[model samples]
Target chain A: MPDATEGSATRREELLAIAAGLFAEKGFKNTTVRDIADASGILSGSLYHHFDSKESMVDEILRTFQEELFGQYDAILASDAGPLDQLEQAVVVSFEAIDKHRDEVAIFQNEAAHLLTFERFGYLAERNEQSRDVWLTLLRNGIEAGVLRDDLDVELTYRFIRDTVWVAVSWYRPGGRRTHTEIARQYLSILLEGIHCA
Target chain B: MPDATEGSATRREELLAIAAGLFAEKGFKNTTVRDIADASGILSGSLYHHFDSKESMVDEILRTFQEELFGQYDAILASDAGPLDQLEQAVVVSFEAIDKHRDEVAIFQNEAAHLLTFERFGYLAERNEQSRDVWLTLLRNGIEAGVLRDDLDVELTYRFIRDTVWVAVSWYRPGGRRTHTEIARQYLSILLEGIHCA
Candidate 1:
């Protein structure tokens, strides 16, 4: 027989994906275990076997996405790229994530504040801090390297980029008109070169 | 004695303001007309004397805000300022609006999409199109004026500016640490000179 533990883990991941989709499409407060199970074509009891509550499933879904995303950010920070290059890479990678994992990004964007209120989801605050640190570090490094404007407010810049990029998840439909690469390229253009014609 | 027509109109405006505040705080779908009436210390029937329905109240609230906002935009377009100057003024005026009419902005941001699907709210879609036109015109004019970089993608540039400024409604308290002007100035700096040290 196949490994029961491995098979169960795969099944758990599949169910989580289904739940994430429902939570994203329908608001988190509006979704329930019954909705998730129905969407996944499983009985509600079977879903309970995988996750104790919808909250638990959504918690796992968001936590996993954050871990993977922050891992990429951490690696970029640790890389040998210069500060400006690093910031650019971070933006590019972020847009890519939005394209690749649009549903997860959407869920986080729409539901994170509500989730963060619960003690069980305290890690969301940490992720927000970590995200801030990544941008701050990059901006500080750029200032140090004399590549970014010294007069720049790193906090404001971080918030600007963070808000601008993540908010795209709301209207960013993949396989639509603009490809992710094109969108990123366009954003980086305005971001780096300024939009004034000169 | 107050003119009865004018008094009723004033009362109607006050009720909408109360409803807008509640909608912004609790979200449109979650907010009930009863709650709004209770907050206003009036019975639902009394409130209905001013507004036929909750839908009509919201419709008035959003329509009034958009009309005033877009009137300013139209004036800017008709102004003698250069494209870059026009863009700057538009940004400043937007931030000013956010400061002066925050609850309206928040409600529009949170509920416009949901509201726009209804036949009565068709103008929301038109307002969006008008907004895009305003930004795109300014961007394209800047490019044609040879002030902004010719390579810039006007559409994406429009979106970046749009998202960055409007999403501030989520966290932008009117009397917070930074004045809207200060925040707008810093944002304009980053938008124009970018974070790159030069």
Candidate 2:
């Protein structure tokens, strides 16, 4: 039999997952605690047992997702791999995140701007800066290592990379034609070696 | 002295521009006829002298913008340029649109999905398909011409190009540090040559 504490923890995760889906499908402002509870087949009071409010629910969803994503990024940055390899690994990890956390990625893309206006969601803004820094560090390191072109505009390149990688969440389906690995590999190919044939 | 007819036409254009800005800033559904009239510093009834409803105002704004944009794409497709040049020109024209029609682009990005659900906004769905066909044709042509990699996934490439080009509206500010031309050039360089220094 499952431990009582483990059972409650699993149920909590399940509730958060249901809330994340509702938040992603309906705009965060439009989704209520009742809606999440209904979607989870629980009463609103029961949902309160797991989370106090929708704000806390979304906060946990975003915080947990960003923490895991940033951890992977930090690990890539700290790895002894060459700059180019680190950059490639970063792209791979991003697509993996999209595949695994599609709802979280969508919620971040759609809600972060509005959410950041609130004092509690200030960390979202910091996360944006940290993401930018991660890409810039990779690009700058690549340039210094003489692998990436010196003429590359770090800021624009970062924006391009960021846009291309994350925007995949809009159309990427988990069980769709291509796996996340396939998409990431193709994208890396185009990024590292232009589509122009030699 | 301004002619009455010409004056009304100019006023109509101005109102549409205002509506586009508001719809872009606060989403289409969130904006109301009174809000537009308020922004225009006119009574709601007087605003109705030009547009009967907020729907009409947004319709005019999006219609005019798409007509102008699609006209440019048709011209590009009909031009004597090679496939690669056509692709480059498409990117150039896209950034030009971002520079010239920032608010319209923002409206399309933020509200198109929601707006397309209405029967009146059905054309927006067609416009999306047309845009996809444009890119696919360019990618297919390039691959056939031996200019692009044969192994390229045209669909994914189209998404990448579409995302990278249009997502610029999120960060691109006209009269900012970089000219649209410069940004487009750098982006084209990255797309065509990759960032890797030979």
TM-scores for the candidates: 0.88, 0.91
Looking at model 2 chain A, which ten-residue stretch has the lowest summed lDDT? A1-10
Model 2 clash pairs are none
Candidate 2 wrongly placed segments (more than 4 Å): A1-11, A30-34, A42-53, B1-9, B30-34, B43-52
Model 1: residue A149 alpha-carbon error in angstroms: 0.2
Alpha-carbon deviation at B70 in model 1, angstroms:
0.8
Superposed by TM-score, candidate 2 places the C-alpha of residue A122 at a distance from the truth, in angstroms, of 1.8
Model 1 CAPRI quality:
medium
B101-144: candidate 1 lDDT, tens digit per residue: 88899888877866776899998999999999999998888888
| Candidate 2, lDDT over the whole model | 0.90
Measured by lDDT, the strongest candidate is 2
On a 0 to 100 scale, what is the lDDT of residue B8 in model 2? 56
lDDT of 1 by residue, A8-42 (tens): 55777888878888877776776778888888888
